[model samples]
Target: MDDARRTAAAPPAGPGTGPGTGPSVGLDIGGTKTLAVLLDAAGEVVAQARLATERGPQGVVAGAARAVRGVTRQAGLTPADLGGVGVGVPGLVDPGPGTVRHAVNVGVDGAPLHLSRLLGAELGGLPVGVENDLNVAALGAAHLALAEDGPGEGDAAGVDLAFLALGTGLAAGLVLDGRLRRGVGGAAGEIGHVPVDPAGPLCPCGQRGCLELYASGTAVAALWPARTGRPAPVELFEAAAAGAPGAAEARDRYASAVAAAVRMLVLAVDVPAVVLGGGVAQLGEPLLVAVRDALARESAGSGFLSSLHLPERVRLAPGRVPVGAVGAAVVGRRAARPAPAAGDPRPAVDHQPA
Candidate 1:
């Protein structure tokens, strides 16, 4: 039940004008922890907080509500001052009804949990939006890509980026021509479950040789102990770096699997950039270099693959910020905006490459 809070002073700004005019809160709910960030109108983070996630649907909602309140209080604001709250859940979500269809890692599954309504109630009916965590994290990563490269806001218009998260599990967030693409069933970017080996380890999703079993942090941590008598994935990496027997080969296989995933994404969607993220992405440049080297090997053997220049397209999520939380904040801010009428002309889809 312990919680931690941190605050930072925002530059002088006047009170927000309406539901979509003020600061917003973004919460990233993971299997092990929940992170909340308060972002002002211009997207600068004003305060942040973290807490252990509670088990079950109701506990998850309560923990999130507490996180929101704690961060706002730290920032010297209140729910009334917020534009809205956005949450990124690590599971299936039907955003239309603000329901979480399943989030097994957090103990929610089989039944729809009305997450937004519960969160709104906690915030005195302030607007709330819930979406797949990877999707929003992709949004945040795309925004960072745009900011790093040039001037336009990273909304669905200016950035075409793919975010590959290598966390406890693996998945992707796709931002194409400025829009987040959640396929028909909201499962467009579930790349981790893509079958890669006919006889690989079994995935919780009832498949063998899924990519996550080989590339995710969970997978690496699990495999390292069995193969090298190591207790942690980090130690395995360290051992590999020191040229320990069998470690380098294992590391290479993991990297190759990840590279294969990236190649599949680029070949299918033609995105210009792939941003590597998630907890495992903390491996940073070494991981990126391994992926790059693997891609290079593949491309050297196939001209078609080389034509895509996959190596140059890969980038790491920016190391300086909490991208998932900031992205959830962005989603929350957008949710607070008035929806466009049915007959209104929608923004034209951008066709530019990432």
Candidate 2:
């Protein structure tokens, strides 16, 4: 919006066929796997690739480089044809230097991994930007939102939304006025650690009754462990549908806790949308319906809450896209482009969900 970020109204001549004028590559590096996407100049994901993530500093860099090449090649391009590369990984990241630390999931710790520089070198010095995994997911979600709804008239800032990830642990990624909010200490959108009940069970963060303990995927597993080796969320929902005793109640309780998370984000940031993502979200419509219902029920008695349309604000992340990888591609595009003045346009894909 201000610096190192600008969206194009129209794409270049071809799918990033020239230096600094072609498609960009984005990588979402997780502990188990690395997902990659090739975002063409038209803002569409032209190709994608997935690879087993090699751990440790060396493996991460090499794996990321390989992912970039694989995705680009899938698009019939090469690293040289890419505008830039973007990486999203778990842990603390200083985007300025493209360095990451405390990324335990990727085996990076203590010493900062100069991921951008290292990966850039591996790929012939192409510009590479590194960002926190959650932040990139938020970016990717925002990109999709803008694609669905074109930029508002006279509104320099684009979409306003929060990406709530109910994975193993609960957390959120904030994209306010079309910009990623990393917060001062990079703790923005960490609503999972917020304590709700003073007398509840203790959390790993030393808080009692933290929101995560109630709302996360792990919480669902605890509430209804897999009796048939299927995921707990699926089993719980199926059982509830079949009138399993207490399953319905447990499901509703979990939904209410997630609804609380949505409420907190809307109250704090008042983002117009809250994209439900992460593992539990894989349950799709069931999960979305449950959370929306909980929001409606919890706000029933409060006129103030009803006026906010909190339930309407909740939606599932697009099932068709690898959001994290797409967001990383956006980062890569930003790295390749010059910073436009504040309020400049940003990328928006033209393709609809396939």
Candidate 3:
């Protein structure tokens, strides 16, 4: 794939019009790397690649531009010969302003993303769109989480959705009444740093005991120190599965923290199904079963919630882990649209950034 990536399409030239040709570009700027994919209107990946993120905003932007250009070349298309270019980042993004208020890994803080400008300067005026990664994941889950046409059709249709990303950081996105909520500051779904343990450990937010302190991928790495440790998280989970006592303790600690976080989510967002994603969520059924059990017991006002048809079923997302990026594409191509009609349940995803 690496060698094959050497051959791809060039992003569209300027701004051109034609029949729908799928999202012109979809870039997911991850903490560790910047990833971009080009797809046709049919949601098929024409080209894709990942670039190692260097330090500072300039480096990040340059690396990202290279990725966008590289993938575009692979697809034999220009930026103008397609739909919108959607990007999903890792920080508190002010979608209205395109300002990444602060980003730990991407080396951006209060930086204006003027993606249109980036596209103009970097890709010859390609129409670019942006969104936060976690929100994109929720959008991704909302669309694909629905059961394929089946006997449970009505039940699936009426279901509300939510998702949590338990990766390096903790964050969630909520889709209510069949719509994505970007919230006032565009951080509505970000409660990961709400201090679940005030007196416990210090959080990346300069505070102590943030929910993420106990539940995120970072937390897992911290909790199970690498060298002196039995092994890293992946190995630890394996050991736990094999009935290693030490691994069991580590797993329980992780589960307990996740349970507390899950309880908070159940109470705050009354969605029907909570889909878990991200690196840590890859534990699959073990994580879900633990979370489900915790919610059944620790979730407050359980009886009341059960009465209100709340405490939605907790489940794992249906697709591959990278679905979050796909969600980001949806955010650009569909979810960012206007609100649905009063009684309409399907999302009205037409607002593809004018």
Top candidate on TM-score is 2
Question: What are the per-residue Cα lDDT tens digits for candidate 2 across 1-354?
Answer: 111111122223254554446688888999998888878876677777778898999999988988877777666677888888999999889999999999999899989999999999999989998888988998898888877765342232556889999899999999877678878888999999999999999999998999999999999998998999998999999999899999999999999999999999999999999999998999999989999999999889999999999999999999886899899988888787666568856532111111
Answer with 1 or 2, whichever has the higher TM-score: 2
lDDT of 1 by residue, 95-210 (tens): 76789976998999988899999989988998898888898788778656665644343444657788999987888988877778888877788899999987987789999999
Off by over 4 Å in 2: 1-21, 150-156, 339-354
lDDT of 3 by residue, 1-354 (tens): 442234234443333243333555666787777666665564444456666665466766676667766666666655555555667787667555455647777777765655435643576654555667777677667656542433344332344677888887888887766666777656776778897667877776799988888888878887676655543567667777899768778877887777666656767876667778887777778777666655555545466644643225677886433556555555555422344579965644321222
**Deviating ranges (above 4 Å) for candidate 3:** 1-21, 43-47, 73-76, 109-111, 146-159, 197-208, 227-231, 296-312, 318-321, 334-354
Model-by-model lDDT, in order? 0.80, 0.84, 0.63
lDDT of 3 at 232: 57
Candidate 1 vs candidate 2: the lDDT winner is: 2
> TM-scores across all candidates?
0.88, 0.90, 0.75
The TM-score-based order of candidates, best leading, equals 2, 1, 3
